[model samples]
Target: MGEEGTAMRMVLCETEESRRTYTLNSFGQTISSYEELCYIISGQYLYFLTEGIPEGMREWIEEELGLVLPAEEETKKQLEHIIGYRNYFTVPEQRMLVQKMRTAYLYSSVRKHKMLGDLYLKHSRYLSAYHAYQKSLSGLMQLKTKEQQEVLYHTGLCLTRMFRFQEAKEFFKRSCRLKENKKCQEAYFIVSYMHGDYQKFLEDGRALSFTEEQLSEIHENISGMEERFSGSEESTALKKIDYHRKKPDDLMTRRLTWSMLERWKNEYRREIV
Candidate 1:
């Protein structure tokens, strides 16, 4: 009985070592060499290891190899690169980079489309940007949890640019609820202001419905512009019309409003004989 128990212990020990050996070999397959695995653990080969691997696989590889990988640091660096690319690139350059990233299936491709959407919106190419933003949003939707809030916020920006203000407001509100980020707050305020503007324009036929503070700000801005043009002959010849009086009539406003309302209408309009 003593000899049998000793044999069982020996078998268990061998099985554990074999399992460890298999894990080590699997790590070897993923990396270039045992030396490269050591470099990865030491944070020197992180870029090479992460280049072709998905985000989910990195931790598993780290655990199996008994290595401590700088996954968070690498992610942060990638995000910084994405933001820099967005801020520095021109419209054509951004579009070109987005196209290349998409073709290569790079992890940054979704972010590139999102940044391209913003560039297009800045250039006032609203419809084109909306498509790009939508694609970014779709890519993010596949991710779990609230990881896609940035994509949602950018989609709201695209909708607002396209003059789909109500839809944009809803999207922004949802994004704010999800992430509570500064971008979402800014989008919320813009949507709220635009909603009020659209209502004043359509319902009351008012050029603007400003609060006291907003009126003061607008007056200050106009006064500043007036000073710049004080000596110009063109400024003297310019007629400052009261836009309130010239506000579109109810009939015209209704036509504009109904155009959007018709999109939500369910009935089909048929031709009469």
Candidate 2:
């Protein structure tokens, strides 16, 4: 039989009880949580389960499938498999698995996009990561506050790395408004300054009720940024342009600015915060 036919035949021959047994016995426990489900099916990308799954995502997947998702096992064999997969799985294979996890499994739209974004961000695919994060934004209200903050923060970080400073600053600002995240707030100020909106940065700080100490820190950061660019042609060129310009207008300045931005992007630790 063909592969598809064989797979279909196997599915046709399987009973719910048998499926349950297959899920439970293979993993050595009932799948009681989304974290366990995500961990096993995705093979080794444990960070996929970093965010708490929405409460509504559980009932449908569990109740309809009748397959008891097993708990995460810490057995030597399982650990070895996880390690091997991380070490050996090709990027294409991992990407394909992410798609399968999105489709074959019943994940909410927000959850699916968040998972996609996290995977892309982890791999340093900033453009794709930004797209995935953008997909999750409309559904942010459905997620908890922490999740919302995470999505926004990641989106901003991706834009920042791409050197879309103005757009990135808006996301960071929104994330800061969601709650008082020091990282988000700092990113907001840094990107605002980078985008040549230093006046608004100071205004925003005051409007947000930033403490004197926080304002001092921002000033320190500004001075540090100025020091970094002091001798660079990019900084000199940028200053000659109108202060309101979001990006460099001259071709040489654009090239120089991109190179400098790359250095700043490299300074960022590759982790979702």
Candidate 3:
């Protein structure tokens, strides 16, 4: 956090040298432009106010930043507007706010993106949720283990819902690596199984310390999927594995396998010709 008193005492920049000086005096942040300055001021004020401002500090901050601070009533109205309509902000506006919030606090953007992701996920907007989670992950710096794991788990869920099982499994794997919690471990196992790596799924379930009952539950879930998707491509792959053939199962694996086959066919076209 930038020192409020120091920020108030500092002079506005008119040149590169003065900007450098301001940055040095503030939070070691480089303020290059007017927009950057506004972001910094708002973000710093937001953080300071959230932490309880000292007496008369608010007036000084407002004066120094050359802006009128929003009153409680106005603030409430703005919050209502933002929260009431999911489409109140256009895509660009939402992105701009996310970037601007990054200047206010270390974790502000991350938290904002996570909130957006959860909202999108709840609405079944998996692609939007995935992008929001990606941004959240990108903003992570020196975050706690649980925080990182949480973002990773949710990212996996987004991918899973999109039917990108291979990518989802990778995310779940990364989450499990951070901390082998049951939720993440179970997700990883399910995703791995869904991606057609049943053997690896079973091995990892045990190696990752999942209980026997959990493993059985996971297996039963897989069995249920097999029964539900019978005669489908996924079920055919599962049946092939059951019969001991080296067949790729699951939608994603089958797609990749078919893509490879297509490439092979194209390569052999010249010989056939």
Candidate 4:
């Protein structure tokens, strides 16, 4: 062949090979080298490189190739798989899988931690849930919305479950201050009462307005606790009214204690000459 013809043929062959690399995923799409490298980092095509490229082209694939699909889809598939069968794995295996799932950059960090918190709560892992909710709050609490309120409330609930009412009160009060919700207020009053701060609940409870439904609910809790306390004769058990079941999430723990504070605030009076 002539030198000019040979040079032209070599150029055509090189172009065809380049086209093959870009079209490897059969997505019928082609992007710049920059975009392809992005695909590699996203891990959509990392495995494809080892299998698709010839040994001689390994360097080129590493430096200039790409993945072809959204990493989120793969992440979802993995999550689904884990949900379907992770119970079969040991605790360490589950932990490793969960940690691996957290590395999915496409997923929101708040959502990741919230889901982790929910999963932990499902297993009655209050401590783990508290930690997860704390992490989520770091990212979400600044929004000062219902989601933030819920996370703060959940954190308080976790602390309350662990018998850390003082710490729980801090979170519950913060949530109430951010947005005056019925739940946060009730939780705050309850936790404050639980921690032996009757003065706060009595002094603050009356000033905080309540919905008719909330008032009715609070009254019911008061009546129920009165009956329970009246029925018991054990003096040492005055503070242990939550013996039957869960406390923080239950209204009973706060019921007996809160009722006493309410009575003191409403019926009692001081006179000055």
Candidate 5:
């Protein structure tokens, strides 16, 4: 017979007891013949017995049993309430509850990894946070969503702090490609700045096409940092080399020169503070 005919023949042969056995057996639980009918009846009355049936089959089961199943919405709210009480749970208890929720709600692996990553980040465990973020990204790569940006951003930041700059740059660049996320823009800028290619920084800034206010703020912050770092005798020698290389023909270069001097002054002041 054809596939559809075979399926129809199987359906026609299924009695109510047989349907119940099918559902229970699909979950791999063996039911003794003596207890099967009683178990099926109990499952019908409590509505707890349709564990393995797909959602489309649910309507068929309800029609055959002459009873309505509880709406999934109501069941979800009840589960959420039971799991949301933070004060009642210890660390291990909270972890167990999160795992149970993952299974119960059929949360995808990416979501589960992201949740664990966030929890570890909150606790200041950088290595664990990095691992979870990596796992989250691996799973999230299969889906089409903006959530991937968030995972990449966090992973990049963690890797950057861990001094894994090349890997971090990859993530930061990926994040910047995704639409107008201010955090990603800032992260990209910071990573470029750290690489110390001033020309690249200027090029990236142009590519980002920041607003006037953003450009002004970035200029001011760079000036402030240069001033702060340039005050020392050691910094003075470094500034002279940077100045020669940059070739101070423009107003911006001159301002950068003065900012370096100011940083030295601030450093001196901090000794007295």
Candidate 6:
């Protein structure tokens, strides 16, 4: 081969390799431009993902930069939502769109479920948040252990808000078993109080990181509840359940928890009044 012809062939070969190393996939789909390479390399793609892109911006990204995203229907819907609402509304407002996006495919998306759970929690919709987090935890395609502890914590918080203290206590303990945090410890104590396990709480709580002031408040609350119910029964002041105790199945446990939740709500109302 002539020198110039050989040099041109080498340049073409190097360009193809550069594309593969930078933006081309195994199937040979190439990102259109050097800007796409820059975005991928700099991690700025994440920023665009969070902020979302307008139609004009999307066109610019595709036409000017040649970065085509995956075109899956559910993914497109989610991406549009993520990109469409930048500086327009609070995330909670955007989260209402979850109900709109609740097709089977979207429901199967853990990211969607988790986003909906966050919005539900943000608005104090504990029941909705609980189920959403549960769905995310049990996602079929990929059960992410990375968020399991957080899911446990949030699910426990939801149960606590719903007045299902026993279940809440159990979930918090599960989260703590995975990884301990002060919030989880305090929440465990709070649920223990609600579960009427005051003795266990006081004994075990001493080892937790609650401030002395918080501990004093808990003591006062426990004392009041005890004084009022001392002659009634010591259900909460007793030891924790034994490991061999027969736990109910999910459906039965849910039914029982719902039944108990109603009673607790009435009791809570009476106390407040």
- Whole-model Cα lDDT of every candidate shown, in order: 0.45, 0.58, 0.54, 0.51, 0.52, 0.51
Provide TM-scores for the models: 0.33, 0.51, 0.43, 0.44, 0.44, 0.39
Q: Model 4 off-target regions past 4 Å?
A: 1-105, 142-144, 203-273
lDDT of 1 by residue, 1-273 (tens): 566557432111111111222222212234433333332333312223233434444454444443344655554333223323222344554455445444434556565566656555554455655676677776776544454676677677656544466788777777776765767765555445434354442332122233656544544543454356454543332223211244433332322223222322211111000
Residue pairs with backbone overlap in model 3: 43-104
lDDT for model 5, please.
0.52
**Residues 1-273, model 4: lDDT tens digits:** 676656432111111123434343322234334334333323332222212332323334434433232334543443333223313344564465455545543446685676566655554566667777877886884444887777888888777666567788888887887788888887776655554344455544555654546545665574565556544444234345443244333444434544443332222111000
Q: Candidate 5, residues 187-253: lDDT per residue as tens digits?
A: 7776666555656667667776766566557856866765765556654454454431354333333
TM-score of 4: 0.44
**Clash number for every model?**
0, 4, 1, 0, 4, 3
Comparing 4 with 5 on lDDT, the higher-scoring candidate is 5
Q: Could you give the candidate ranking by TM-score, starting with the highest?
A: 2, 5, 4, 3, 6, 1
Candidates 3 and 5 compared by TM-score, better number: 5
Error of 2 at 207 (Å): 3.7
Best by TM-score: 2
- Residue pairs clashing in model 1 are none
Please give the lDDT score at residue 267 for candidate 4.
24
Top candidate (lDDT): 2
1 or 3, greater by lDDT: 3
Clashes of 1: 0
Estimate, for each residue in 147-180, the C-alpha lDDT of model 3 and write its tens digit.
7888888899876655466788888888898887
